[model samples]
Target chain A: MDAIVVSRLTKHYGAALAVSDISFSVPAGSTLGLLGGNGAGKTTTIAMLLGLLLPTSGSIRILGHDMARDRFAALARMNFSSPYVALPHRLSVTENLRVYAHLYDVPNTERRIRELADELDLHELLDRPAGELSAGQKTRVALAKSLINRPDVLLLDEPTASLDPDTGDMVRGWLERYRAATGCTFLLASHNMAEVERLCSDVLMLKRGAIVDRGTPGELLDRYQRDGLEEVFLDIARDRRPEMVP
Target chain B: MRPALRRVWGMVYRHLALYRRSWPRLLELAYWPTFQMLIWGFTASFFAQRLGNGGAAGVGVAAMGMLLSGVLLWEVALRTQMGLAVGFLEEIWSRNLGHVFVSPLRPWELVAALIVMSVLRMLGGVLPAVLLAWALYAFDLFAPGPVVVLFIANLMVMGWSVSLGVVSLILRHGAGAEALAWTVLFGLTPFSAVFYPVAVLPAYLRPVAWALPSSHVFEGMRAVIGPDAIGPDAIGPGAILWHELAWATGLNLAWLAAACLLFAGQFKAARTRGALLSIGE
Candidate 1:
């Protein structure tokens, strides 16, 4: 079974549809990049997948568990990370990690926390309150939190958006290493085209709440006749839907 | 060791961690109730002195007793209400609600955790005030015996009921409705007869006061304490205490049931509207 499956998923905020008929699947041990511009339903899709928002219609399956019916089973093995969401501000970094570690029921929590702190270079900041961390540090903490569960399916939204280029690259590298080591599937929603190109096996591009295009990075580049994913993204953003071989 | 209990304990430990590391937070837990006790204690003393010398010794002691009990007992309700609501608001302020909901934690578990924390917070705030009342005014809120326990429990549940309703509003409308956390309980105060007897209320407002379970508790308190002050029974103690307990148990339970249903509906609506994750933001 796929790590994540979403079919005909629709979310409407009253009269306005936020995510419309979006369908996709991510095979186990592969990364799928969800690309979209402002109001393009990337966050909405993530929210639905996390069961934070109920879809107006359709379904989500994570790790073969139907989210609407068996969400806790799926949630027990899945984790989400977004820089916009945060840990409790007054708690120390280690305190924050311990809470999630307990919630996820991670065995040998102390050892796991130590490993994450060492791997993320968070050992120095572990004693500092979460509110006191710089944006870059907070991003790393969020990444560590998402990994605390050692989730089978990881969903990340704009994970490195707050970091400098060096830190962003490092985070991406760490994610690559983690995925390679654990064989966890990832659904990443990001605007960084180069990052997506570097990590994703497949890309799903959303336009106005609908999946306008989807393919492998090289395939999309070849079809759009562009040298890079950035140019192709612009083409979609500008509504210049490229001709397809069908 | 069950996973569900472990998850609930994780939430409790999370809030406790916040309380542990911050002195200001700890100070806040005891400050307001202590402040209220001091103010009311002095006011009660002043009334007792003036009226004792004014040839109405019985009226003076009764007034002092009512005021002192009113202030302390009211904390049971206030702290419980604040505990549940503020505990919820903390997640929103920290932008951690998304992280919490994404976990395997169920909504009912969240409610259970909040209620447990409310009990802890209520004790933390009220106990200090209780001690201070003893040191300063020689008034033992515990003097009412085992019935005080029931009285406290009833008030806390009533507070929880109203707190849940307030939280539901905050969930639906976001931070703009946060003031309800502090204000909603106070709105019910006049009707509760916390400072005065139900008989003091205007005839038209009397029915509204009678509907409040807290009104009965305070009235029972007056009956329990009144005879000692006046040298004659104001109301029969046995009849009033049991009657008040029965009314409070029933009314507070109904309030709690309604609040839970309201909260469930509000949570569903908020999740559907995508309001849960963005509540404080």
Candidate 2:
């Protein structure tokens, strides 16, 4: 079963088109990379899927629930994280987690919090206010929050955007383990080609509010005649469309 | 507990945690109301002494009671409105509204949580002023009897209604419209007749004053306080009190409905525009 299915989704901001008739689906337990430049509608697509933004047209179904009519049910089974968004600054990490645990209606709240703390290595930072945390620390806390409910689906936008190389690798490894352990579906939006190549089984490249191409990392590399996704991304972004071998 | 109520409680808990740890936040809640009480209290004392010098000590005491009551009760409406608006603004300021809406919590559940938070904050701010009014000046806000509860309920509903309107404006126009949250109700005060009877308004503005539920509430308060509290022309205090109360209730119902509708419409527009994720200071 597919965990997410978006059909011809279109969004416009007045006369400006933010997302234009994009369609895709992610199989249950699979990781799908959304690769794009700035204002490529990656965030807009994610927002619509999360029911935070209304689509100008088209439909979204998550875990078989239609986002327009039955979003709350689907939302209960899904969660998202972004470095750009933040938890309340005044709230401690524990308080923030406790609040989200309750919001998600997680049973055994304290036990779940402890489990996340252990997994995220947040024991030292649990008492610290969210605003005081460094960018790296905030990213971990956000990841912990996204997993608080043990969601069937998780959306991540720039999951490691600000982390140092070592910390970013650690986070990427953690995500791999978490996905393997729970078989949770992931829709990751990132400019980090290495992160996408390492984690995404398949990737969709977006440009100007539409999907320009899609394939596995290996397949895209071969098609673009490049050794890395960054080179392929540069080619696509610079409008250097290679001819199809077929 | 049901999941919906738990979600509401979760939102409430988030704000409660902010207050619990921060002394400055807690102090801010009570500071303005107390300060307003002291200013009005001293002013009322001066007027009462003037009336006593004219050999109308009874009138002076009655006037003082009315002034003090008006100050305290107006704070209820003001604080309640601010409580709800500021609670919402905190989410925006922290850039947490997207995180909140992405949760399973419904919009109505958020509204319920905010209403509960507003009442908590209103009591936190106004209760101290009530105590000080009684302690420093022999004025008991509760002296007019159980009817005071009805007055408070009406004013609180009015406060929530006004807040709903302010929140809707913010949703439509973003943070640029936030000043309305603090200043809108103050603009309405001239028409609310808080410290004076509605009859004192210019004849042409009487209908405009009567249109607001608060005017009815204050008028009812004066009628219940004494026979001539409003004026000698005041007839049948019981009838006037009940009449004003009825008007207040009806007007509040209409205002609340309109405010809810306005908020719902603007909320939908915000979603379509993707403002929820982007709106913040």
What pairs collide in candidate 1? Answer: none
Candidate 1: deviation at residue B20, Å?
2.1
Residue runs of model 1 more than 4 Å from their true location after superposition:
A244-246, B54-59, B228-233, B236-240
Candidate-wise lDDT, in order: 0.89, 0.92
Task: Give fnat (model 1).
Answer: 0.82
lDDT of 2: 0.92
Per-residue CA lDDT of model 2 for A106-180, tens digit only, reads 999999989988888899999999999999999999999999999999999999988889989988999999899
Can you give the DockQ of every candidate in the order shown?
0.84, 0.91
Against the true structure, whose DockQ is highest?
2
Best by TM-score: 2
Q: Pick the candidate with the highest lDDT.
A: 2
- Among all windows of 10 consecutive residues in model 2 chain B, the one with the lowest summed lDDT is B230-239
lDDT (Cα, tens digit) per residue for candidate 1, span B72-149: 898899999999999998888888999999999998888888999999999999999999999988888877677878
All candidates: TM-score: 0.96, 0.98
* CA error at residue A32 for candidate 2, angstroms: 0.5
